[model samples]
Target chain A: MAAQLKGARVALEVDNVTKRFGGLTALDHVSFKVYEGEILGLIGPNGAGKTTMFNVITGVYKPEEGRVIYYGEDITGLKPHVIARKGIARTHQVVKPFNELTVLENAMIGALFGTRHGQITEEEARSIAMEILEFVGLAEKAEEPAKVLNIQEKKRLELARALAEEPRLLLLDEVLAGLNPTEVAHMLDLLRKIRREKGVTMIMIEHVMHAVMNLADRIVVLHFGRKLAEGTPEEVARNPEVIAAYLGDPELALKFVRRLGGV
Target chain B: MNDTIRKLYTRPSALIAWGLVLIFVVVGVLFKAGLVSLNTATIAMDLMVNIGLALSLAIIMSYAGYVSFGHAVFYGLGGFLTGYIVYNAVQTAYTANPQNFNLTFGRALGWWLEGAVLGALASAALAGTVGAAVLRLRGAFFAIATIGLDYAVLYLVKLYHNPLSGSADIPVTQLGAIEGFFYKTYVLVTVFFIVTVIVAYLARVSKFGYGLSAIREDEDAAEVLGVDTTRYKVYAFILSAVLTSLWGSITVWRQNSFGVDIMFSLRESVHMIAMNVIGGLGSFLGPTLGGMVYYALYRATLTKLANSQFIVVGIIVILFISLLPEGLVGLVKLVRPKLRKYID
Candidate 1:
C-alpha cells in the first residue's frame, strides 16, 4: 500500500504550514502530502487543528508561515473564490446551506460560480446540479428548500454541492460527525463511488473512527496541533504515540488495531 | 443567446417590470391625447419617480442584502451635479451676451442630459471607490458606514461651496424660460423609470444576481463556493448609485431648484427603505408595487389626516413587518404557491 502511494503523483502538498490566532497556534508547522485519487483521512482530538487546517487550505484563514501546493502550483494566501476556481472545493463541518434557496438552486450555485463558472450556461449548470443531486440521493428533494433538510440529508446536500463544483481535489470537513451507523455506511459507500467514478482526490476530516479507518487509503493523526502519526490505518492504529494521543488506552488501541488488521 | 432572450421574456419578474413600464406608457399616451388632466399626468410622473427610486435601492438592498442608509448621497450628487452643470452652462451662455441669450427647449434638454450623464459617471466613481472600503463591513456595521458616507459627501459639498452655482442654492428656474419644461422633464423621468425597471429585472435573473443572492445568504460560504463577493457587491452598488443619481438630476428639473439642506435629506433614504420593506425584501416585483402602494397610501391619507399622513405610512410599514415580513410578494406567494417561481 505504501509502495503504491509512493508511485502515484502527489495531488496536494502542505509544507510546514503554521497558523496562529492571536498568541495561540492552531496549526503548528503541520506538513502532509495527499496522493492522487486517494481519500486521505485527517483525524485528531477536538481542538487539534483539523478544521483550522481545512480553513487554511481553503483560503479562509491565511497561514502565518509556509505554503500550500496543489499539483505543483503554489496557492497559499489566494482568495477563497480564486482557489475554488482553481478546482479546489470543500464542505463545511457545520453545514452552511443557502437556507431559503431550493435544494436544486443550492447545488446550482456551485456550478454557476464554481470551477467551470461562466464556461457553462445556467441550463447546463442546472443539469449538472441535477446529476450531482441524483448522485448524492437528494434528487427527490431537489425542489424543497434546503433549510427543511434533516441533518443526514443536509450532509448529503453539502457533499452534493461540493461535487457540483467539479473539483480536482475535494475537502470534506466532519461529514460523518452527526450521522448514525447506517447513514455513515451509506456516506462511506457514496464517497467510494465518488472516487471510483469521478477519480477526484479527497481529504476528509472525520472523527468517526470506524468509518475513517474503513474508508481512508491512509490516516494522519494529529495531537495538539502537531502530527502525531502518519501511516496506513493498521500502522497508525498500532502506533504507541497515536494511541496515547487519540484513544488514550492501550486495550482500546489494541482492539482497534485488531479490527483494522482483520479488515 | 436566443434561449437567454426567451428565458428573459418568460420570466415573471421581467413581465412585472414590463407591465409597470407599459402602465407609464399608457399614461403618457393619455396625456398626449389630452384625455388626462395635466395634474393627473404630473401625479403619474411622480409615481414613476417613486418606483424608480425603490427599484434602484432594490439592486443593492434587496438583491445584494446591503442596507444602504446613505443612498440619498448619490441622489443628492445627481441633483447637485446636474444643478451645477446646468447653472454654469446657462450662466456662461447668458454672460456671453446677456440681452440676446435665449435658452431653447432643445438646448435646455441637452444641458440637462449632459448633467445627468456626468452625474451618473461621478456616482459610479464614488460607489466603486467607497464600496471597496465600506462593503468589507457587513450587517449593521455596513449600514452605519453608509450613513457616514452620506454625511461625508454632504459636508464635502458644503465646504467646497457652489463653485458652479455661484451661490449656496442653484436656481434651475431659468430653465422654465422654455415652454412646457415640466412636461419634457416628465417624459424624461418616465423613460428613465423604464430603464431602471429593466436594469432591476436583469440584475435579479442573471448569473450575477445568483452570485449576489448567494452572498446575501452566506458571505463566507459564497466566497468559498467561488463568488467574488467584493466585486459583485461593488458592481451592484455602482449600478444602484448611477440610477439613483440620474433620478436626482431629473429631480432638480422637477423642483426647479437645488438646496443642500433638502437634497441630501436622510428621510429620503428611510423612505426608500420603507418602500422596499413594504413591497417584499428581495423580490423584483416587491419594490415596484411597494412604491405605488406606499404613494397611494400617502396621497390618500395626506388629504384627510394632513400632517399625520406619515403616521399612517408608519403604521402600515409596521403591520407589514410584523404580519408579513415578506411584504406584498409573500402574500401573493401564500395565495398561489404555483406562481412563486413565475413571480421571481
Candidate 2:
C-alpha cells in the first residue's frame, strides 16, 4: 500500500479553503492533496472540523474562500448531487438506509444515481447493485429490509452503497466507529482489500488509531479548524504538535508520543 | 412468450392491482348490461369513484410521505368547473327554445365529457402552480398549507353571487333518461379509474418512482444520492391532482348540482384522507381496499348519522392509525409473509 500509488497525480485538491458557520469558523485555510489510489487518513479530536472538511469536499458545504479542484477541474459551490454525479461518494457518520426498501434496492439507488450512468434503467442498476453487494459480502441479505440489519451490517451496507456508485473518490467517515474488536479488525481488512483490489482513492476519518495507522499510507491531522500536521502515519504519530492536539498538556503530549513509539 | 409475460409480473403488487381493476371493470360492465341490479351498479360506481380519489391522494402522499389534508380542493374544483361547463351548454339550449327545457340530453353527454376534461386540466394546473410553492414545506406544514389553500378557494368562490359564476351553486338540468346518465357517468369514472391504476403502478415501478421512495425515506440523503427530489415531488403532486379532479368532475355530474359547500368542503377532504389512511399509504392495493371499506361504512352507518358522520370516520381512522398504521395490506403481509411479495 505504501509503495503503490506513490507520487501519483493529485486526484483531489483543496487549496486555501476556509469554512465559517456564523460565529465559528469550522475550517480555516485548510489545504491538502489526495494522490490517486492512496488511502489518506484524516485524524482529529472531537470538534476538530474533520467531518466539516468531509462536508466541504463532498459539496454539502461550500468554502468561503479557495476552490476544490478534482483532476484539475475547479468545482466550487456545486450542489452535493452534482458533485456526487461527477464520481464522488460519501458515507454519513450515522448510517442512513431506506428502511422500507430492501438492501438491494437501497444499493440500486446509489448505482442509478451519483455516477455517469445517472439515466440508467432500474434493471441496469439492479445488476450493478447486486455486483456491489456481492463484493461487500451482503449478497445473501439483498432481499431483506434495510431496517432489519444491525449497526455493523448497516455500516457495511453504507459502504456497499457508496461502492455501488463506483466513485472515483470515496470519502469514508468513521467506517470503524462503534464496532467490536473483531468487527474493527474485519473492517480494517476490508479497507486493505478496498485499497489493493478496488483501487478507489479514499479519505477516511477515524478515531480508531490502529485502523487509520494500518490502512493509511499518509495521515493528516486537523486541530482547531486548521491543518495541524501532515506526514506518513509514523511521522505524524511522532509530531509534538499532533500529540499536543490530542492531549493539551505538554507533559501528557510527550507521554502520548512515547506511547505511540516516538523517541 | 411466457418469459416475456413473466417479465411484466416483476412486481406482484402491480399484477394484483391490475387484477383488481379488471374485476371492477367486469362487474361494472355486467351491471351496466343488466346482468346485475341497478342497485349494484350504483354501488359499484360509488366505489370506483372513491377508489380513484383515494388512490390519487395516497400515491402522492405515500411517495412524498406527506399527508395532504386538503385533497378535496381538487375534487371540489373539478366538480364545480364541470358543472359550470355543463350548465352553460343547457343555458344555450334554453335560449334557443324556452318552452322545451333543454332536452339535448343526448348531446349533453358530449358537453359534460368536455367539461370533465377541462376540469381535470384546471385542477392539475392549479397543483403545478401551487405545489411548486407549498410542496416546499414538509410533513405538518404542507398539510396545513393545503388546508389553507382549500379554504381560500372555497371562500373566494363563495364571494361570487353571480348566477353565471362558480359560487352560484346552480342545479344542473335533467338531461336524457336516468339510465343514460348512469351509464355515461359509470363508464366515464371507470375509464378514469383504469387510467389512475395504470399511472400509479407505472410511477411505483419506474425509475421515477424509485426516486420518490428515496425522497420519502430521507430528503436530504436522497439529494446527496443525486435524486432531483424537488422535481419528482412536483410531478407526483400534479399527477395526483389531475386524477382526483377527474373523480370530482364525475361527482358533480352524478349529484346534478355544484356549490362551494358541496364541492370544496373540508369535510370532503377529511373523507378522502380517511379512505387513504384506512386502505394503506404507499401500498398499491391500499387505496382500493381503503375506498371500498370507506364507502361500505357510508352505506352501513354514516348515512344514518349524516351530520355527525365524520365522527365515525374520525374514530375509524384513529383506530387504524394506532393499531394498524400500515392498514389492511400491512396486516395481510404480516399474517402471511409468503404473500408479501405478491401484495406489498
Candidate 3:
C-alpha cells in the first residue's frame, strides 16, 4: 500500500497554508499532499486545527497565505460552490442535512448543483441521488425527511450528499465521531467499499484511532496549528512525538498507539 | 416538459397554480362579456394585483429564504416608470404635432404596453444590482438593508419632478380616458397575473427551485454542496422584482395617476410579506393562497373594523407565525401528510 501510494498521482496539495482568525493563528504554514485513490487520515488532539485545514481546503475559509492545489491547478480562495464544482466534496462534523427536504431530495441537491451540475437533468439527478442513498445504506429512508434520521443515518446522508456530487477528492470530518463500536465497524466497511468501488481519494479527520489506524494508507497528525507528524500508520504509531501529542488526551493516547502494538 | 411535473394531474401545487389561473381567466372572460359589474371587475383586478405582488415576493423570500422587507420598491418603481413613460410619450407626441394631437385607443394602448414592459425591465435591472449587494447579508440584516434601499429610492423619487410635467406627479390619466381602458387594463393585469403564477410554479418545480429550497434550508451547506447561492438568489430576486413591477405598471395605468407617498409606502411592502407569511413562505401555492386569504381578511374586516383592519390582520399573521411557522401549506401537510408529495 505504501509503495503504491508513493507512485500514485497527487490529487490535492495544501502548500504552506496559513489561516488566521483575528489575532490567533488557526493554521500556521500547514502543508500536505493527498494522493489519488488513497485515504489519508488526519488525526489531531482537540483544537489542533484539523477542521480549520478542511475549511481552508474546501474554500469556506481563505488561507492568509499559500495555495490549495487541486489536480495540478491553483484553486486557492475560490468560492465554496466553485470549489465544489471543481470536484472537492466534504462532510461537516455537525451534519447539515436539509431538514425539510426528503433524504432523496437532500442527496439530489448534490447531483443537481455540484460538479457537472447544469449537465445533469432532474431525472438524472434523482436516479443519481437514489443510487447514492443506496450506497450509504439510506435507501429505505430516501422518501423521509432528513430531520427524522438518527445521528448515524445523518452522517451517512452527509457522505451520500458528498458522493452524489461526484467529487474526486472527498473530505470526511469525523464520520465515525458519535457512533458505537458496531456502527463504527459498519462505517469503516462502508468507507472501504467507497474507496474500493469509487476509487475516490479521501482525507478523513478522525478521533477514532483504531478505525483511522486500520483504514488510512497514511496518517497526518496536527498539533496546535502545525504539522506534528506524517507517516504510514505503523511509522506514525511508533513516533514518540505523535505518542506525546496523544498523551494529553488519555482516551486517544491509549488506543491510538497501544492498539497498533500487535500489528 | 419538466420531469418535476408529475404524470398524475392531482398534484396539489399544480392544482392550486392552474386553478388560480383559471379563476383569473373566468373573471376576465366575464368582464369581457359585460356580465360582471365594473365595481366587481375592479375588485377582482385588485385581488389579482395583491396576489401577484405576494407571489413575486415569495419567489425570493419563500424559495430562497431572503426576506426582502422593501419589495414594494420594485412595485413602486414599476408604477413610477409606467407613469414616466406614459407622460413622456404622450406629451412628446402632443408637442411634436399639437394641431392633430389625437390620443387614439391604439396610441394610448401602445404607451401603456410600453410602460409595462419598460417597468418590468427597469425593475429587473434594479433587483439584479441591489440583490448582488443586499443578498450578501442574511436574515434580519438582509431585510433591514432592503428597507434602507426602499427608503433611499422612495426619497429620491419624491425629490425628483419630471421636468416636462414640472411636478412630482406624472399623471397617465389620458391613457385611462381612452375608451374601454379599464377593461383592457384589467385584462393586461389578468394576463400578467397568469404569467406570475406560471413563473412561480416553474421556479418551485425546476432544478433552480430545488437549489433555492436548499439555500432556504441551509445556505452555507447549500453553497458547499455546489449551489451557486449568490447567482441563484439574484435570479430569484430579479424574477420577483419583474413580476411585482408588471403588477405595479398595470395598477398605475388603472389608477390613472400615482402618489409617490403611497406607491413607495412601506405599508405595501409589509402587506406583501404579510400575505406570504399568512399563506406559507416557500411553496408557490402558499403565497397565492395567502394572498387570497389576506385579501378576504381585509375585505371581511374593512367594513366591520374600519381603520384597524391591518391591526386585525397583524394579529392573525402573528397567530399563524407562532402556531404555524410553515403557514397554510404546513397546516395542510399536518392534516394530510399523505398529500405532502402532491404539494410542492
Give the top-scoring candidate (DockQ).
3
User: On a 0 to 100 scale, what is the lDDT of residue B188 in model 3?
Assistant: 77
lDDT of each: 0.88, 0.80, 0.87
Q: Could you tell me how far off, in angstroms, the CA of residue B182 lies in candidate 2 after the best superposition?
A: 0.7
| Fraction of native contacts (fnat) of each candidate | 0.79, 0.60, 0.85
Model 3 chain B poorest ten-residue lDDT run: B1-10
Error of 1 at A87 (Å): 0.9
| lDDT per residue as tens, model 1, A52-157 | 9999998999999999999999999999999999999999999999887789989999998889987988899999999999999999999887889999999999
Candidate 1 vs candidate 2, lDDT winner: 1
- True lDDT of residue B320, candidate 3: 94
Give per-residue CA lDDT, model 2, range B18-60, as digits (tens): 7767777887778867898878878888888888788888667
For model 2 chain A, give the 10-residue run with minimal summed lDDT: A254-263
Which residue runs does candidate 1 get wrong by more than 4 Å?
A257-263, B1-4, B162-167
Residue A9 shift from truth in candidate 2, angstroms: 2.9
lDDT of 2 by residue, A1-263 (tens): 45655658899999999999998999999999999988899989999999999888878899999889988998878888788888888888999898878899899989888684546666778898999888878899998878899898999999988888879899999999999999988887777778788889999999987667667778889998999999887778778788777735655444433544321
| CAPRI class assigned to model 2 | medium
Docking class of 1: medium
> What level of docking quality does candidate 3 show?
medium
Which candidate's lDDT is highest? 1
